[model samples]
Target chain A: MAFLTADDIALLNEPQLAHVATIEADGTPHVTPVWVDTDGEHVIFNTAKGRVKHRNLERNPVVAISVSDRANDYRTLWIKGTVEMTTEGADEHIDRMAKKYLDKDTYPFRKPGEERVIVKVTPTQRLSQG
Target chain B: MAFLTADDIALLNEPQLAHVATIEADGTPHVTPVWVDTDGEHVIFNTAKGRVKHRNLERNPVVAISVSDRANDYRTLWIKGTVEMTTEGADEHIDRMAKKYLDKDTYPFRKPGEERVIVKVTPTQRLSQG
Candidate 1:
């Protein structure tokens, strides 16, 4: 079965931030609010290297992400997946993240070493309800 | 160890909204965004009676909630818990919800049957990183 319905994808495409959960080796869960960008195929986000989420993903990539809009009643989206980290290209990573959160005019350019570690989630399951 | 740090609790206490995940009977996860309130004990939220989140809770109450601050550099709160639903006092349910999201001065009084069913989460784990 499809993890997300048409309505669920609609909810995710709305411009909003989402909370992401990453699980630790001992089974503890770590969650953080992140700005996300979605293509028809995957969801993307970033985090610092020293953070627990980063560590959790290194140990195990299983995760859950939830998103919503406030004024629209109780609309929400939940995505579960494996996180794939990329250091593919510093400039490109920064560019994608900047576009998601900053307008073109204010988007910051990044130096090669200053780029964020990017994560792409190919959602294994998505559930949404309002 | 505490699932959330002191800084995590402060983030949770902020007026921002959160995305919550409730698990289904077959183990799929349902997530929604919600306005949350903290009494320093449990996190509270509500859902419509017929929604997937409500049904998920009835079958399996395990849930995860994530909250954050936007302007702050990556501040976040991830809470995992068991959900308890209440139909206990309709008037009080409406009152508490209104106070959390709406102003007390303009809060609407509910007829007993018009109140929302409330859910209380006793967080078993909290993890915060930013």
Candidate 2:
């Protein structure tokens, strides 16, 4: 497994959006933006249980994420990884993500009856450019 | 096939970077940032021969692209498409992309012995959010 570099950790600590790609049942790709974080070992993001990405990852764990420096597009972190998802601590995780991305004490867009899931991606391949 | 909306076209016209995902032979995803464009009917981008993206697209046309407004991360476009690659006009195309992205008359990163390829993606699905 590939390990996150100091630069990668620094980028993840910034308030930047990450574009995540997952494979559909038909072998096509699905991608969307998400608030991103890193535990210094795995890349983490939060999603609702019924989201397209959650469904896709449930079937196929393989995923790719691209995060670029908002100020410098050339500085980017591209990670190909497999995800381990859980509901454990997902509520607090989203609140932490909200603090980073929205500067809110809690996620402002939480839907009623929605079940939050935290996805931890263990990088198998990591590439960066600047 | 899905068509680009005026908003999608406008987003493409901006100097935003796009994260493109292609499937590797191992069924894993590879993603990176690229200079993005559109020809009204298709999403377009440029790359050189022997690049991982070029090789991946040559093997599997299925692709996904995500482009978020630099100023507002919430404004984003996510597209799943099939690519049609060509060497024809690729040189001129990169120059145009250079003009849009780098404000240069020509692509300044051209390398000796590198063959540029133009990739046009016919979107099968387009999703947007703000």
Candidate 3:
């Protein structure tokens, strides 16, 4: 497996958005933007259970994430990885993400009765460009 | 097939980068950041021949592209489409893109003996969010 560099970790720590790609059942690609995080090893993102991405990842753990610096488009990272998802601590994780991305105490868009899932991706390949 | 709204065309006119996803032969997803454009109908991007994305597209025309406003991440566009690639006018297209993206009269990174290809996406599905 590939590992994220210090620069990659630093990039993830920023509040930039990640464009995540997952394979649909028919093998078509589905991509959407998400707030991203990292634990210095795994790339992390949160989504609601039963969401399109959540469903896609449940069936196919393989994922591709593209992140570019908000201020510098040339500074970019592409990660191909397999995800391990769980509901544990997903609420807290979104709260942290909200704080990072929105300076809010909690995710304001959270829906009532919605279950959150944290997707932790172990990088099989990491590509960086500046 | 879904059509690009005026707002989508306006977004494409901006110098924002697009995160493009294509399926690998193994059915895994590959995504990268690319300079984007639109003709008010189709989403267009240029890449060199023999690249992984180029080869992937040649084999599998299915593609996904995500573009977000550089100033506002929430203003995003997701497109699922099939691409038509051609070398015709690709050189001129890259120059135009360079002018749009870099304010250059021509693409400065052109390599000797390298041929460029223009990949135009006919959107089958378009998703927008703000």
- Candidate with maximal TM-score: 3
C-alpha RMSD values across all candidates: 5.5, 2.0, 1.9
Give all TM-scores, in the order shown: 0.64, 0.95, 0.96
| Tens-digit lDDT string for candidate 2 (B1-130) | 4499889899999999898888878887778889999878899999988898999899999888999899998777788889999999999999999898888998999999989999999998875421
| Candidate 1, residue A101: lDDT | 60
Best by lDDT: 3
Superposed Cα deviation of residue A5, candidate 3 (Å): 0.6
Residue A56, model 1: Cα distance from true site in angstroms = 4.3
Q: Where does the lowest 10-residue lDDT sum fall in candidate 2 chain B?
A: B121-130
| Model 2: CAPRI class | medium
Q: After superposition, how far is residue A4 of candidate 3 from its true place, in Å?
A: 0.8
Residue-by-residue lDDT tens digits, candidate 3, A8-105:
99999999999999998888998999999999899999999888888889999999999989899777789899999999999999999999999999
Ranking according to lDDT, highest score first: 3, 2, 1
DockQ of 3: 0.59
Flag regions of model 3 displaced more than 4 Å.
A128-130, B128-130
Candidate 3: true interface contacts recovered: 0.63
Scoring only the A-chain of each prediction against the true A-chain gives TM-scores of 0.75, 0.95, 0.95
What's the alpha carbon RMSD for model 2? 2.0
